[model samples]
Target chain A: MTTIFGVPITALYGQLVVGLVNGCFYAMLSLGLSIIFGMLDIVNFAHGAFYMLGAVLTWFAFTQFGISYWWALLLVPLVLAAAGAIIERSLLRRLYRLDPIYGLLFTFGLALVLEGLLRYKYGVSGLPYSIPDNLQGVFNLGFMFLPKYRAWVVIAALLVSLTTWLIIEKTSLGAYLRAATENPALVGAFGINVPAMTTITYAVGVALAGLAGVLAAPATQISPLMGSNLIIVVFAVVVIGGMGSILGSIVTGLGLGLIEGLTKVFYPQASSTMVFFIMAIVLLVRPAGLFGRER
Target chain B: MPNIVKYGGYSLLLLAGILAPLVIYPVFLMKALCFALFACAFNLLLGYTGLLSFGHAAFFGTAGYIAGYLIKQSSFGPGLGILSGTLAAGALGLVVGNLVIRRQGIYFSMITLALAQLIYFLYLQASFTGGEDGLQAIPRGRLFWFINLENDLTLYYVVLAIFLGGTLLVYRTIHSPFGQVLKAIRENEARAISLGYDVNRYKLMAFVLSATLSGLAGATKALVFTFVTLTDAHWHTSGDVVLMSLLGGMGSVSGPIVGAFSIVTLENELSDKVGSFVTVIIGAIFMVCVLVFRSGIVGEVSTLYRRVVGQREQ
Candidate 1:
């Protein structure tokens, strides 16, 4: 095997794959955060909780009903979306008129409640979800061995993020969302049912997090504490990518993942913080973020 | 008559704090006082400047590490070590605050958290921090040439002086014209800018001041505990300080100290009773405080007192 930058090709490729997989989660989660922030002006701090909820729920579905991974891929989002909708209507809706800080505080509370409930039910230890029979094996690419499940996760997350971007940016529904985000009153005046649209938008965003969680279940440990750790990193991704641009978030997520992977290969010590280190640099050069427009 | 009584009541409270450690466990009281100072420093940003920095643990924890390292590894005494730690934290705050203050509201919070996490990672990797074990078993050392901090009584008085000094500094800042400018900026930045005040400068100053003071508290804490760990610098520590300020009363001078004491006491008691659910409880409190008591405990009490006095006069 050849060496790149004094590291084995396999080692480099493996870290890159890991980075891509992590990036996919970042993109999906950050996409959700950006979309919700765009329309609601509320930073949904409970998003990680929702993602954790997805993983836990998937585990439950499998254990209780013998539901397979294929079924979970479809079912988890619907369940999480329904939960998200209910939460929006019941608690989140009330804080729309207040400072955006209130939304953050409320969602933070929601996160604690959700995580606490999960921890209560299933202790801090993680539960394992088996790789599906079809994607259980590894494929050897000349230089590296690739896990089929991880590749699938990256492809699936890419598809989800691209589809979300298309629906919000290219389609008529996307047009309506853009209008609603920009001028809710005007959109409502035009008979767009802005409130319902807002509710749906939030649900869809959260459902994205759920879908990511499902994908992550097999790759990482399915634990209640997983989301809290990941969300802060995702927030940095959002900051670096700029919440204003959809494509920016996707590209930044993937790019940052690659950078992190490279760091792991060359300097394992900095791998954990490679994304944030880049974020600091980005902030210094472009205070509004690379894609964020000056407000 | 009532105004004089209120003033007298505050003085009595201060007197009690000075005298309490004589009777109670000085170590616990010292811990509380250090945390109180930390909370007040945090309040300077969130309460006065309206910037909710979620990464103050960087200052608090990093300073503790620096102070600990200096006393244990170097020739410097405790005072010099603490000053160096505070300056280090202040320098870090300046760099971070410059970057974060560009964004407003939730974005600011995220930026601070991310930057703090970066510092955490740096510390984790740095040789001096000792990673997971952290820098432990630091010498408390004497304050000057005479006072041995190894004695609980001597340490308690030292901590008391620091806390009192910190509290008075915060008080002076709150009453200063500079503080009024910060309040103005917090209430309405555009208006303050229109009024010819350089809002960003005021904010950065406040941020640096808060970071320095938080570092001072952390440095003192390291001396008191004779150890410094990664837990102090973690994002959760930042969140804990936020909870302290919010619980105490954001804008009130004594509110953060009260908030810090209550929260520390509550956590100690509750964690003893129900080990794992403390976070859930704290989170619940955060939600409740944000929704129902935005002005916080001190703010609410003061308002109620004023109202009751008005009723009596009527």
Candidate 2:
């Protein structure tokens, strides 16, 4: 029954939870984008399309094969990664030698094709996916009620992001990936198959998007257009976080998400554009981004 | 000898374009001309300056709204309204360009897009834009004192004049020393900076010039159609312009014009038959253009022409 800053405390807390949930998705997707941009110097504009693909693919699996969310959590990323590898090998490989702008254009085209095809088959309307039975209940957390599904999403996403960070920063494979990103030709001369590594890196980045998409299906509407909206925001997050650092993207994404949530509770009109407002301010102050090193 | 013949061929093609509206519907031709100008203006930055802005819709659509509002609310004629609208867009570009020009490559594109979206949200909330319905029922108004733009023919000639003026201006800019410096920066910024050129200033000038021309086109378009809507200001409009520029060929002067006309004509003819499939076809064309026709229609033709001339000379 307490009020904080002229609004009900419970309502404020509820929005904060929603904000955190949204942030989790932003962190995951922007982290993937940062990794891809850092390594390839190519902005993967079709990242949203891949995310949409993940949701649609999950829906298809559920309807046809009765695959539950548990199985989807395992299978979706692998499928998306395989698709990403094929796209890189077949289409993206040709663009590596050209200007980075061409990579953006090519991916933009790919996104349109993917979204259009999905719209053609499924229409613009979304399909509903239920949360698994085990996570159907809600918990009273003293301050506010929390949905079990949302809590699960936050924990799972954090774990996934942490694991990705550890693998890339700590492991030998991660070392090799980092080294290849810095100097592909030198890495290749040292007996690393740099081209194959590049392909796999793109796949891993795309797989992260797919994984996020699968997590999102139960929380949000499973629609083709969903990814398009989120992708633009994620781009802002990536810019704010600096495209070179994975941890920067994660922290920025989550932080911005909470800020947006707070705005919704305090001032509803600015909520939609709060993230962009911050982005503009960040751009003016530090063109290289908060966490990015200047080129 | 062959060079003269090629010049003659190009002149004839220009003559054909000028005379086409007489045979075809003038309204449709006017729409195509507006879009052609818009695409050309966009190409000035992307092709010549090597800055790919993803928020051009902000200028185009905002100008449309401003022009629409003036014609609807004030007694100002279409000419003054369009001029004011263009100035508004140019001023906006100056501010936005200053902020965004500091970043290069993908970051620049992202900044433009996000800023444009912010403008879009502003328009959505502002009472002057009429919210969702937009500024509707805008008057065509008279051009100067005598010419009535209510007639389709009068509007067509007015649009033609604007398009011609814009094209010539762009051509002059391209041939200017400033444009040469821009190209140098585009090819290699480090080299240009080392050569003591202020690359940021050149980029900002180009951005403002492109935005002004695009705004002129959009303002004229609002007068011609007598309507301004939120659709014009959306990110999709920005994407459409980019697609047109890319489809035509980035570096060539006449490419975007050709691309704009062809795309508008194709969409008009096919939309009734295919419905939403137009998006798919456009996307396919984008893919095909990026993958197979990197040089674009005009670029390819010029290359072929040069090759043929060389063979003949030999």
Candidate 3:
């Protein structure tokens, strides 16, 4: 019965919850992108494609092999991580010495190829993905009902993001990564296998996207076209957050997701463009991004 | 290439353009010309200026929509409609260029891309764009006061003229002293800055110029196709431009034209037989071009020609 800004409180809460769920996916994807950019100095334009691959491959396993969603949640990332390793080792490794923009162009092609192959086989119609039985119910949150699956997604995504953050910021491997990001030549001189490190870092970064895709499968219809648009919004999220800091990307992704939710509540028209509009404002005020240090 | 070879090639191409409509489908040629001009506009930024914009379609598509709307709804003639579209695109370029030029290199590409998506969303949601159905049945009305464009042949010439004009403009811009500054900035931004050139201003100018020409191409395409759709503004079209420029040869004057024609022909040939596989083919071509053919058709041929000549002289 209560109203805020002439909208029902329940509707507002529902949108916020939806936004938070979306934010989780953004956090995971952007975190991966930030990590990849930091270590490899290459923007993985195909991050979205890899994420879609995770979901598609998961769905493929489910339909063909009777593999459960629980298994997919663990298996999909590994499969894609291996795929990422191959891609990095074969295609991306050659372009490291060239301008970084070549990396973007190369991945953009990879995305087109991946999305096109899937579209050719499956057609453009949405493929159904059901939530696991245990995660089907809704939880009473006093003011509004929250879907159990969504809550789980939020928790799992947050946990994964935290683990990634800790790994990059706290561990000895993280130390090596940070060092390599700063000066690859110096780190290579220290007897660390930098090329191997580069390959593994790319694989892990892609695995994060795969994990997010698996989490997203039950919530949304699986489609070849799903990742293309979502990736652009994530790009905007990366720009606003600035790829310099790991936590910065996470917080920005979540924060932008919430803002998007609020916009949908207040004015649905601006919801799609709110993130980009905010990006323009952020670019104007701080060209280096909120968390990015000026080079 | 030597001046004799260059001028001879241009003359031959002009002759082909003048005579080809008789042999080939005017509609298809017009489409290719429009895309060729669009790629040339894209090349101005990416090739000459060393700024890769993933959002050039914002200008191309927006101009198409505007030109389509004006000629269809407002009864504006094609000339005025296209002119208005080009100017409007220039205005948009100024605004977007101002914001995106803040970042250099890869970030520039990302920001342009994100802003373009914003524009795409705007077109998708706006009523004027007709949402999903797109602005359809756009008449290719009379040019100035007379010239009937209802005939395919008449319209083909107009589109060709526009394509040539746009391309010449790009060529002139590239050879100008201003273009040299752009190349310098591309090679070394800090050095260009230290030399007392206002680097941002130069970049902004090139961006706006590229956006304006892209709009000109889009506007012509709208007239040629007799409709404007969301596909024109989509990021895929932006990617297509990048591919065209890259495949033909980035930073080369004739490269985008060759690239555009080849891609257009390939798509035309394959779209019927393979359906969605066209995307895969294009993507594969992109990968091949990036990996091994970085210099592109023109760049590689020129290099080879020079190498053989040098050997002969030695």
lDDT of 1: 0.89
Residue B10, candidate 3: alpha-carbon lDDT: 87
**Which scores greater on TM-score, model 1 or model 2?**
2
TM-score of each: 0.96, 0.98, 0.99
The candidates, ranked best first by DockQ, are 3, 2, 1
Off by over 4 Å in 3: none
In terms of lDDT, the poorest run of 10 residues in model 3 chain A is: A286-295
Candidates 1 and 3, the one with greater TM-score: 3
Q: How far is candidate 2 from the true structure (C-alpha RMSD, Å)?
A: 1.5
Ranking by TM-score: 3, 2, 1
Writing each residue's lDDT as its tens digit, candidate 1 over B202-233 gives: 99999999999999999999999998999999
User: Each candidate's chain A: what TM-score?
Assistant: 0.98, 0.98, 0.98
Residue B99 Cα positional deviation in candidate 1, in Å, after optimal superposition: 1.6
Question: Of the pair 1 and 3, which is ahead by lDDT?
Answer: 3
Cα lDDT tens digits for candidate 3, A250-290? 99989998899999999999999999999999999999998
